[model samples]
Target: MNNHIPILVEMQKLDDVIAEKLVLTESLPKRLSGLKKDVEDADNQVSETKTRLEENRKDQKLKELEIKSNNDQITKYKNQLLAAQSNKEYKALNSEVAHLESQNSLIDDVILQLMEDESSIKAQLEEELKIQANAKAELKANEDSLNLEIKEVEKEIKKFRDQRNNLAKDLPRALVKRYAALIKNRNRKAVVFNNGNKCGGCGYVLRPQVMIELQKGDEIINCENCGRMLVFHE
Candidate 1:
């Protein structure tokens, strides 16, 4: 049995585990950021709704003031009519009062429409506020758990790397260096199995002589195409 082959196999296994943990560690931060974004989007929706509601309410107040001002003008015109010195002046005062009344009627219709809009907006705002509150609570509840999970994954990755280093110490220094370089350059695959005369790493067809050498497993055999160590698994 080739000692380096078995050690390389073990190292490959450790690398596989490290690869999985690295992917998870990388994704955890993105997941946490997604959650944060959800919360932020919900908050923005609530804020926008509140702003619209405030503007609508302010418009409603302005409309009400305008109606009050119209009524005051109508009242002043009626008092002037009572002291009118000519028929023309009296008729003019009456026309002015009628116009003010018609204007007030139009403003009243607008106010009614605004009130309906306000009601709908208030309902929508209430719903958005609830959504925002729930999103905040969910983010707060999961934040610590997500951080802890990422830390645990980091620890596992560190442990696997340390184990790999320890395993490398038992192999020849040159062999370990070759393995490390292959793993770095070959997508983290230093040793690959020969699959039916095919190079498992690069899927290149293997020569009969190369397959024979891999089957003996007496020494490290490199795949001709990928330069990865080829091991025959009985």
Candidate 2:
């Protein structure tokens, strides 16, 4: 067996761990982003609810002013009816008063509806605030844990990478470069075994001569299809 084969296999083991931990460092942030999104959504809901409540109160205030103006006009019209000079004038004044009262009735109904909406909005705002609080709390907890995990994963990768590099010192420079290239290009796998008639890395069918050479273990061998170092395993 070529001395490089065993060293390559050992390096592959270290690289495997480094690669897997690197993936964790990436995915942990994505998980944190999702948690942040939940808090963001809750904040939006709370803001919207508060805005609705403010608008509802403003609308209620405007309607109250309108009712007050209508009442004042009704009192003035009543006074005019008392001093009316003819039946037609009194009838007209009375009709004006009735119309104003009808408007006031409709306005009252609208004010009541606005109050109900205000109540509902206040309740919704309370619930949304609670949700916002909970989301922030949950995010904080997970964020701390995920950030710690990311740091730990980074440390692990660095440790394994250093080990892998030190191990590579035992091999020739050209072989190490070739292995590194394969690892970078082949999804962090540089050494693979035969799986029946196929290459374990790419599932490329191995030729009979290729199988015989791998079984002999006389020298370093690569798969024709994938160019990965192949080892024989029963």
lDDT of 2 at 7: 84
Which portions of model 1 miss their true places by more than 4 Å?
none
lDDT of 1 by residue, 1-234 (tens): 687888899999999898888889989999899889989999899889889889988998999999999999999999999899999999999999999999999999999999999999999988998888888888899899999999999999999999999999999899989999998899988889988889999999999898888898889899889999988965
Model 2 clash tally? Answer: 0
Distance from true position, residue 156, model 1, in Å?
Answer: 0.8
Model 2 agreement with the true structure over 6-89: per-residue lDDT tens digits: 888889899888888988988999999999999999999999888999999999999999999999999999999989999999
Error of 1 at 9 (Å): 0.8
Model 1 weakest 10-residue run by lDDT: 1-10
lDDT of 2 at 97: 98
TM-score of each: 0.94, 0.94
Which prediction has the highest lDDT against the true structure?
Answer: 2
The true-structure Cα RMSD of candidate 1 reads: 1.5
Cα-based lDDT for every prediction: 0.91, 0.92
